[model samples]
Target chain A: MIARLLMSLTAVLIVASVLWRDPAAPVAQPHPRFVKLDKHGNPLSPWQGPWSCVLDTTQQLVWEVKTDSENIHDGYWTYSWYLSGDPRTSDRARGEANLGDCYFETSRCDTQDLINRTRQAALCGLTQWRLPSAQELSSLVQAPARPGHAHIAQDFFPHMKHGDYWSADHSQPLSGHYRRFKQGALAVNFHTGKQYSLPYRNAAFVLLVADLPSEHHSSRTSGVTHQPTTGN
Target chain B: MRKATFVFLHMLTIVLVICSLFTGLRFSLLTQDWLKFLSALLPQGNLYFWHIGSASLLSALAAGYLLLSLWRPYRSSPSHYHLWVNRFGYLIILGLLSSGWLLWLGRFVAIAQPLHFYSLWLLLIYLLMHGWAYFIQHGKYVLSALLPKQPDKHSIAAVISVTAGGLLLYSAAQHSAETLTVASLAPEEFIEIDGLGDESHWQRAPVYTIETHGGINFDDGRSTIQVQALANSQESYFLVRWTDSSMSTNHLPLLKTQAGWKIQQNGFYEFDERTFYEDKLAVMLSHSCEVGADNTAQLGNRPLDGKPPNWHGKGFHASMDGKIRDLWHWKAVRTNDMYLADDNFFGPPAIAQQGQRRYTAGYQPDGKESGAYVMNWQWYKPGLVTPKRLPDQSNAHLSVLPWFGSTPYTAENDDFAPGSTLSSILYRSNRFEGDRADVRARGTWDNGVWTLELVRKHYTGSEHDVPLTNGTCMWFSAFDHAQVGHTRHMRPAILRYPL
Candidate 1:
């Protein structure tokens, strides 16, 4: 019985060793700063910060809490604005929501209520605002110093951690990570525990807008052209 | 036996992988776009990590296999397995060396015109050899026969297989790591002139223009120009003007003329100038000027100009701006003594004769010659008391006199003979005197041609003589005894005359 057990144990050990030896395992290493691709490769989306969503029209989509000017941990303050259109379909709501938790930071607060309020605010606008698509978010992943960033031209959350951003576009199985400097796109596995999020309703910072005239109907949610809000 | 086969196959595969990785990495470095894409796929950090990981894994596996094979008790000794593995390892190494040499030759030498095909063939051959070896070793019952033992053979095979697999993985990792580092830092572009002519006569043109189909903006400083001539099938001469400003101008010389025309700082200009003889040759000169304040100008002299004139024409007035305007003309005349002859040797009293009956020689008053008899004489004849000596007697001891009088030979009329009457006169004398007089006159009745000979002996013992007919004449100096005496010597002897 002892010999049989020893033999079985040896066999098991051999089998286990073979199985554990993963030839294709990626060695633990720092991620590349710029993810280049061939002509056929797709672009990555912006990062998703610490935020959750709930459909509510009564409250603002993203509210900031006033904190110490130097430190974000001091306290909270509320800044409000009226939504001109439905939060679900308005360009303003889409643009604001696609920024992820860096600007929204809804993960720590009432995520569901915040999402609902965002949708309501977008719907309240004279024109509709909705979440930006993957392509739209990708377009914003330009070099940090490019000229087209008029309103939100500056990175809204300067202190936000740098990594891959989540996009509404789920074309690829792996989530996209947009690089900061080169604006390169990378496909990352969300399950690999490499994701980070931003907080919501933080007002110690400022929120920019693209103020368009009332005559134009800005309800179209095509990922092609969505200007940032001009007003505060 | 099974253990040996596994080890052999694993080693062969590892060698092939390494070679392929090396070649691929080199290609990637030469082309930047490919390198960039590769880097993204396998970042530097990951490449290094994987390299270390794979090497360790493969080494561990190989060691484990060896150990297990050694520990097992087999009917056939482990020596047989060891021998097979050794043979297989040797073959792999040989194959790798051969493939590497072929690749290196293709890259560095012109052993073959189309190296790509040769390299590909070599790679294929290596693969085939590897596959052939694998098949032979893995054939059915080969391992069993070699092992000849039950439990020992199985355990030994297991260990060898594991070890080989680990080593293979390790080799791949190392290759990948090397490739990642080298290719990431590859150059972006290789700049070369596609149609530049031969390097020897390459001319630097002033302006180089590049036209790209796409709207690409090149930094002004980084650009260069290449110019070629279609007519001569040669590179044109030019100078590069690197500057900070945008505008520049220059003046270039025209062909065949000493004077060049004023050309704008940056455009093509043409001009023509007349030669001294009023002959005209077209001068085609071109200048390319870049528009910049810091730009400079260079003048290219045509290849024919040996020592180019210093921007000034002699005997011509030039303006303050270096322009040649007016020219001055000068004339010169020369004179020297010469013996004259006529068609007939017996024309006047000034004639003299001295030679034998068949061929008499003398001097005549006219310059034309008529008969076959010839007479030669030297001018500036030496006096009886003093024999003339040549100043420069290095080669021939013959005295030479300037046919025309002394005058500076100018560039304008250098083509014509100095003593020709058409352009200038050299010498003329009226008095005729000599040692004594001797005459031989002959007249041909049929052709009305008369031939005569006359000789004049001077007081100084020197004599002048000539043979002449009605239309023929000859002249000579009797003092030239070095020659065949005055009888065979004469000056300006006429050789031919018409009836």
Candidate 2:
């Protein structure tokens, strides 16, 4: 009888222990705060969006949306690193041009030519289009759930190249002689979310960005063609 | 000495029951959806180790106790009530042990699972009744008898022998599992990887069928896969067929609405897309036949330390032990037209990257030579999207868009009318050229079934691929238009080759 009582007590304790697990805590999911803008710099409805540029309200930046139309803004186009006037050498040295493959009048697609063309065209009703800083470009990356997938949010920035996009950050010389070390610019690889410094002659893709002024941020959002809703 | 022996046996039984009961419940949650909520609290990595180890020890202890009782009959007698309770307790334990072994061996699981669970409840009840009576009769002083001055030498010997015997049994069971034989093809026989099992050679080959369970969008969440393997001197071919009520080929198609283009998906945000997904089949090969995907499936919110948790909480498949397992994946929409199975492998956990929202642990595709497919849209927003390409013709709905068949997307060139649909998958090339295209495969869907045929080299010598040789264990899983949800089965079908 005593042995049986002990066994019963032990069994109850064992069963209780197995059932005494703590529930997993719920994770918090926040809503995205992005607004889409058209070529005329007008905010488009989230549902009716085929926007030319994306305005990231949180970051106060307007991002260029690439296309696949074989034009200067085509996502598949690549450009060589060239600045009209070098910062270190001033006007003495013009970097390599006409080394990249792109659809342009002269077909001489370089970083300087692209920057000049974008400003002249005043894309998205803004002439401040230029290469984004390394930090700014990386901030646009939303890591994919799976490996080997692209890093940007496809919903907002469609037609983006899966390869590297050049940043405005140039790698400075660490030692005494600036000419001794190879000059390069920083680029962000969207596939792996890693930053790389490429030689000035190496061709890469580009996406222009501009700062959104405080006055134009809220007042220009007039034409919302559809109801606003949050989605993945 | 007698008192010490009794105490030792009782203590051993208690410990074994505690270990096996908890681990068994953990495993039961995998198939028993009703109890799935309890899994959140249970520890979930390599649970089979503890369950099997304790079960083996318990069986050995029971056998030893029975033998000793038969060897020397006890002269003393007990009350009728006490005797009946002891007999009933032993019966319940016996039922539990037998059912447990049947379940582990993957035999008659439909019957064994419930029987084992009921026997556990019975054992608990028996213990309560028996213990209550003992305590009532013996009073408080009866506890002192359990702590003998010292454990007897015989008791120590029994413990060592029991442990050794249990380990031996476990090792033997691991090696001697049933093997599925791969029949040889004659010189004149021919086979094609055209997603058809109508070849005469396939008709002559033996078929191995496995009943799978626990996948969404299936009848009662179950499916059965029938597999046939044939080999020649240099190549091996496999024909796999499974039943699915509907043929789902539309994989996240883009719909052009009055507002904009939106992807047709039900749960893409959570990474668990059940609607607008394609049916898929995956075949994995490994040297070890350990259950639960060779122990690669680590369950729980955070199974691996310092790793990002999976979105579904189902778990992740990663070979943390540095061994590679070959995987062949066939998709209805993605790889069906390519006539190839995306050759992939399970390797060690990948290093966590910065800004990665979803981290696919260990699951990686093999190196591809050239051709591949990419999603049609530039970015994905559940509400609206801008497509990467527009169909040359308006209102054309295709399961996959060929690169040459479509024009680059442009606002001026946008001719798709509202309410038109386009395939989300875009082909970069006709087919793959390198190691990623090693497994030439094709699948066809008929009234309610899918027939898939695959052929690969016997030995490609790639570091990521396992050789199609004798003793290689294989597992098959089927996804019925679901992302990250697949039908699973226990006990791998090990390969055997002709001498």
Candidate 3:
């Protein structure tokens, strides 16, 4: 009788865990739209994420904004695009993701953990999430960008830093692409929104992007208004 | 009532109770005095209402369980110990609730603090006692309560799956922690304190990388703090660098807005924890020489026997008696621009002077200048110590946005006006002395990196400061944005002065 009770309880717990979606997951779905970019590099009209996924109305990709405020600002959590001995294949990322805690359970959550566990968790309700390609990542900065303000669209992405982010595309195992943000009280070392190559061992921030979503984009309003660029 | 339903509620209650206990422990740990590290992840002063709310529910349930026992009585012939332990556990739970409620309401912290703290353990003890009683009531079959008579692949698969999941989480933390060696060599040339870290002497210095341990909830663990050190015959120069997504020098200030005396956030005022403290760093040097007979260099505060009812000061950290530890705190706001890190030492308990309060430590420049600068904001201010502001003192505007004036803080911008104690210390104090701001630090938050150059005389000839030697071990903690009673560190890196 006791055995039956314990097994029954464990089964109920497992079922309950999967059925509930984490409320922190992004609410927006993904779709493709082709549009023009302002000279500052911002899309002509602001892109909106129903939850936290930014739909590049123009690029048609869904990008996960580092919604975790602590992660968004934490410099140490940054990672290289590739982990050593990683299968280094896109298909492996597409397989069924076994889930685990990325924050509390681990000693460190690197790019691999982000891909496997965070991806498995189906953040923003998509599982095929992976690193942005070189060009895809480069599109974030609009240089001759204002000093101190994010070169990227603040409307969609807030709490952004000028720190470089890792891009999946790599020339050699050692070298990978990174997208830069404007730095300084003034954008002094501003690179006019360009991509640079560096060693894969170098840590860069992770911002996941997914291909077109199964569900059509949401028309639901996010309630946040866009602030126009004040930068020169 | 169904047995399964009864078990489920009890089981869920147990899980929440355990969670509450841990959160309660964390809440208590962060309240102590000896902390030197800052948490960039958990915003300080975030009240854990969930912890209290959960504990309350647990207490209520435990009460209900005990009352139910009274209604039915333990009829089974299980040991009398089980019957008694369960009752005692419920009583302890009630005790926890009462004390926790008192702690949450902020009353009699001295009494409520310890009672609520220890009650969690007492309650757990009851659980252990009750566990044995449970086995007595159920017999040996309870050992494999969830197992089938025959082991099956499903069970093996389940075990393997759980083990693999643990490994996945464990693998993230598998990197070997390297012992970074800090080589101390005399610089070939006099080091300049300019923001630029490009001097030839600096270029030749040994670079050691240290990793931050806690606050992984926000970080990827890939960020490395670069530490480079070089000492000359006259002075020692240490340069530390790290990457931050953004820079913040915004120290929350006491503001007098249209509504009246207001500050941006009340964390600093309410609890010493700060959400808007300037991005800062600290270096703690504990002398290995003459380490107490106990062989410990770091000293703790003297234990209080009687609650000095009139104790008007914030207490000292872990110091038990006598010797103090050396601390060089670099604040991006209050002390940095002044070319001075807060030269603070922690050791002796606060000595009540006829007119002032003093914590006796070695290096302080005598004239009542040691310890933290802020009154550390406890309700114990002796009198009306309002700061006076003078808006007309100067037109220095704060450069950053979110605020309009040339400066983020101004003496005149506060409720007390010229009396607003002292506003932003960007402009040097008019009556400063040599010892007032001793250690010189120059750094700028440019782009994503803060390049800091710190220079101090090799020896200040103070009994308090231990002269730098080959085997000095100093702990470093970086605060992205925080202040006061803040202590946390992963591992202390090794720094060796050249023979």
Candidate 4:
């Protein structure tokens, strides 16, 4: 009797399953990317060294490559664009301690001064290493597949920081724009793909960009001057 | 008459067969084209509703049949192997249906997805066995009985009814398929500034050290950890050796059986798994964090000069805060067998209204129902006493859901085999839903020393978690046999480099 009942039940389920099956459905296909357009930035040519600097062809800029040890403090390093100033002077909050003073042969220098001092050594065989403008620095960012990390073209710039990096464009004495490796929180830089105007004194990762001859170069550099004065 | 009934059942079941076929279990031969064709011919009104409704009815009917088979005379019919197969088969169907309902509700995602998925395979196998048995026993006679002499009006009506019922069950089953904190501790141990001294290769060790809260006397019967910190470029290892008088593994449980309702008072007279709490260790981490404005998540005052406070905070955060803190809690019972610990943390709740309940974290195995919780039924029921039994006697986990008035485990129903005794150490099950925790730990005990290794990924990418760095500060706590009893220190220990 039990067998009879189950057999009948199974029979009914079979019929139900068939009725619901999708026969004419198209073959499954993967979802398309958001855009079909493809473009790879011009790779840096005339490049040199084990610490190879990249020439971003798309933006016509030279980048000083960063490694885990390139600018290390203990193991990882952090630095401010400037040491201290008020919110109006530099967009940084007061009471935050300075992580370090200056790394160059000089006694004291802001992130800009450090960059300027290092360029004299011609470490990358390129003496024009200047703090990159916020836009130029942002171009190197590829927002990592995972959060709390920076998306650098690691093959060229090894050991990109997951922390914020300093930008050369300073709107106030206290604040300079920085592009963080990871998104920030409230009362702090929050977005990953944009510039976070931080205090010049606040420590961050640094990546210098050297100008290259190109039509887009002028437009990109001049645009930084027009950006509204926003403090970090 | 039996033949007539069988014929009618066959006619009604024809619709079910169609529904089952539509499921495309066999190579999914029926495609969307077939579905489009059927939808045009079918009376469509929320197929999901009708399908689930019919399946529920079918499931209940099958359950009733099982209960009937268990009745006096039929219960003794051990010869009916097919009956037993069908009984268990229907039970699986019921489970599948229940999981389907839970999935629809968007509750217990961890448990329902797997249960709903596997139960389908189990049901299909049993049904095939059911069909094979009928063919084997009744043979040609069974086929003949299902075919009536002519299609009478009653048979035609039964067939139509079955089709409509099939649609309901189809919708019901599809409905089921659709879905799919930080604590601070202060541990104090004053080790040689160079973690390794006396030419012990501690050249690059950290310069600072930490002292425990109150400097609890090791001889005061409180546990003390002789700690050493070591870190190279790759990983950090903390060797914590603690002196424990006894090795305890008794976790509190509720046993219900035939004797009576008895609660084993933990450690009152003897070690009882139902009452004694398991020994535990917890670690929390934070990076560049100040307790957000909310008192719920504060770091107190750790001087930038690397100085800790005079007292250590105990238990959970005194207040709930919006900030994130990564916590790794080590429980002996859950992970010892699997070599995994309950990894948990404080984070934003999946739902908004849950409030602090969302503040809690736990583990339900991936695609499995097991979970771990420090607080259990012991919190509510108090003042019950249980007689001491052989500590080595084994205890079994019951499948009781508790609220359904199921028989609780008692000494009688929880029987001991005659002349045979098994160790009554501890046992657990995988039956939980929602809020899975993340953390892993391994611990070992010998003589009176407990050695534990707490490991977590260096980068968890969790906002609540602090990155493990040389400058990272941590607190510690140790608990012995006493339930909720933990020993902690006042100051946070800096993770100094091992010289």
Scored by lDDT, the top model is 2
Off by over 4 Å in 2: A1-75, A80-113, A116-232, B1-6, B31-36, B65-100, B113-149, B185-189, B243-246, B250-268, B273-276, B369-371, B375-397, B401-424, B430-433
**Top DockQ model:** 2
**Predicted structure 2: lDDT:** 0.76
CA lDDT, every prediction? 0.24, 0.76, 0.47, 0.41
DockQ of each: 0.00, 0.15, 0.01, 0.01
In model 3, the number of clashes is: 38
For residue B139, give model 3's deviation from the true position in Å: 9.6
Q: In candidate 1, what are the lDDT values of residues B1-499, reduced to their tens digit?
A: 3545554435544654454443333222221223322222222211222323433443454455456558752234435645565456545444433433332222222222123334444545564454434335454444454343434555455645665666665444322200000001113322122112223323321222221110011121111211121111111111111111211001111111122111111111011111111100010110111111001111111101222111101101111122111100000011001111111222111111110001111112221111111101111111111111111123121112222232332334323332211111112221112211111111111121111111111111211222112212211111100111111110121222112
Query: Lowest summed-lDDT stretch of 10 residues in model 4 chain B?
Result: B351-360
lDDT for residue B428 in candidate 3, whole number 0-100: 20
In model 3, which regions exceed 4 Å deviation? Answer: A1-232, B1-28, B31-188, B214-224, B289-316, B352-387, B392-394, B399-436, B485-487
| Residue lDDT tens for model 2, B55-159 | 888898888888766875334466999899989989998999998777556566566666888897787688667765666777666567445458779778767
CAPRI docking class of candidate 1: incorrect
* Lowest-sum lDDT 10-residue window in model 2 chain B: B351-360
User: What fraction of the reference interface contacts is present in each model, in order?
Assistant: 0.00, 0.17, 0.00, 0.01
Cα lDDT, model 1, residue B474: 18
DockQ of 3: 0.01
Whichever of 2 and 4 has more lDDT, that candidate is: 2
Better of 3 and 4 by lDDT: 3
- Write the number of the candidate with greater TM-score, choosing between 2 and 3: 2
TM-score for each of the candidates: 0.20, 0.71, 0.39, 0.30
Which ranking of candidates, highest TM-score first? 2, 3, 4, 1
